[model samples]
Target: MNATHTTFAQDNGLRNIPAVDDFSGMINHPNPLIRESSPLLGFTVRVKTLLDPPEDKKLIDLIEQDIRHILLRLEAERYEPGILISWSYFFCTFIDEMVMARPWGIECWAQHTLLVRFHSETWGGEKCYQLINRLLLEPSRYHDLLEFIHLCLCLGFQGRYRMTAQYQEERERILRLIHQKLQSVRAQQPAERTALLSNTVIHVGSTERERRYRLHGLLSVKKIAWMMAFIALAGFLLFNWQLHIQTENIIDRLDVLLP
Candidate 1:
């Protein structure tokens, strides 16, 4: 099945959904867009986060062209356009929170700037994950999966490996085995591996990315706050200036009438 199947939400196991209050594990991992979201409490992956926002002309126009089709399938309302910005920030971040904000392990695999959209469903929460498991074992997508898995390990995402002490040995064993498989594949296709690995290089703190951009989009909150403050201050000054001028004219009129 393709990534946008309607039945995807129904097949998800119980463990896939996280408790709404507990933002631990992948769920709590750095969101790159938390600074931009006004997420409502008690909902799965969203709310005022969507309900309404100041309309940004640039963002709204971009959504009309690119994102409106892929999200919020049931209602005509697409999510708030401000949270969804130039990096395809809103949609990608939405997907991340829904998938990563988890008490559960991501059982499978998976955009933006130029996102690949499928019209069948708004891939969010359970439905988003359902798409992942459906495509988990497919070889074409597996490469992308491994690419993501590599980054997740580097980012300290432990998933089910940290869920139990019994899984500890299994974790090490799985690591070694996967490493072995990678070696075998690399040995067989060194050139292909090299080309793929060399395609993108991201500097992630002490580590880096050997794949396409995943979690790199971040908007500086300090700068945003400062910019907003400056704008408000300027508007206040302008309003005061106008008010002062009006007051002075009123005083002049009163003096002329009294004389």
Candidate 2:
């Protein structure tokens, strides 16, 4: 293994970490099936294992380390686009699992968001955006729609390109669609309605975070303006106080001259 890979393995706890070097060696193995299946099977199994126990810190660290390594390899042209896509799906599956499990925590949500952004960058912006939009709008996949919306908002707010006007328009349209759907389902059944409302709340929270991110620059500007105003006021008060002292001194001098 290379120095970089060795460092990553060490950081993540090497006990169960997949040795990418071993897989690299198998690229030229005589058995065609082993050569073809080794990497994909190994990668899939490692990722799936990370999802078990759901709250395993070591597994989470290992998965994150692996994700960074994969992205680095992709950027360096060491991996094919197909391999990147497979990894993207694996990450998406993990997100879906989290969503299905009730009471999703912030750490898992953050990890999934990072994976989504990485996938978007590696898969090409337009393709990933389209995939997310399709998933968000699909009625059959409503259970996972909130996560998809969060992904879109993440892209719009933090992506290198930012979201275009067209993307923003589409996002608003989808939000409205979801709202309408939620309303229609409200009177049908209590359990279903409650679930949809919860998802909507989660989606709204993400949108609010995006809104805050967008406003960050404006907020900083306002803060600077307030500080400048405060300083100007303080300077004005100091000048007036000095002028008052000078006037009192002149009056005393005049009184002394009259005496």
Candidate 3:
């Protein structure tokens, strides 16, 4: 994180697209989950240069070893959540890069790697204290984590949540939950929390957040406008019902008189 990387564009967890020309920044961890993930450094270069059959085998093997080691430490709760998150982001980014580079045919290189383990199952479940701890307790950094999670989904880091109808439905459920959470938080701590958490728009596979400013913008409308709109809707329904009743009555009378 000490690495000075420029952020071109960002919204919530969506991070700046750091130029991968220099793999140094991506590899530098403040406190690496393991001793050194430096062996994984060759990833950026290989992804950029060559994705040959032999090279694919080596890349797959190295990433798998490092990930397995990290997952073991995670189970032991040996690393801090922040450090774990940094490594999680790195792993997610690795998958994103692989998707862009597409190494082995149509299937993603992630399923072949340990991305599924780190992203889902191995972390245990929703109750896991290691990663979800920071997420629940630290409201300030919620966007940061959510952004990376969204990025993973966007770039196809399918783990327990595969790229299917279920995957997208889960994504929406998370988005909806965050909106409700922020709304509650904002109401309770309007002054302090509003600026910290705000908006994240959705576009194909993007993590939706902040339901737009227009929801809060409702405060700007005139009371009379609301009253008029309500009255108009009521009046229309009332007239339609009255007209139907009148027609039914007339039809009955005509039938009776004819009979």
The numbered model that scores best in TM-score is 3
lDDT of 3 by residue, 1-259 (tens): 2134222111122132333433343243222332233323323333443344332334444455555655455546455566455556556445445444455522545454444545552222232223433564654445434333432333333343433555556645554554445445444553433432322211123234322211131121357478889999999999999999999999999999998
* Candidates' RMSD to native: 23.8, 20.9, 11.2
Ranking by lDDT: 3, 2, 1
Better of 1 and 3 by lDDT: 3
The digit string of per-residue lDDT tens for model 2 on 214-248 reads: 21111234575898999999999999999999999
* 1-259: candidate 1 lDDT, tens digit per residue: 1133322122322234343332222222222222111111112232212333223323223333423432333122233442233223224424334333343312221222112342323333333223334433442424333333333332333334444657555544543443334333433443434333221312122223212233332224577589899999999999999999999999999999998
Off by over 4 Å in 3: 1-3, 6-158, 190-192, 200-259
Q: Of the pair 1 and 2, which is ahead by lDDT? A: 2
Please report how far candidate 2 places residue 29 from its true position, in Å.
47
- Model 1 is weakest, by summed lDDT over 10 consecutive residues, at 33-42
Candidate 1 lDDT at 64 equals 30
TM-score of 2: 0.29
> In candidate 3, residue 188 scores what lDDT?
50
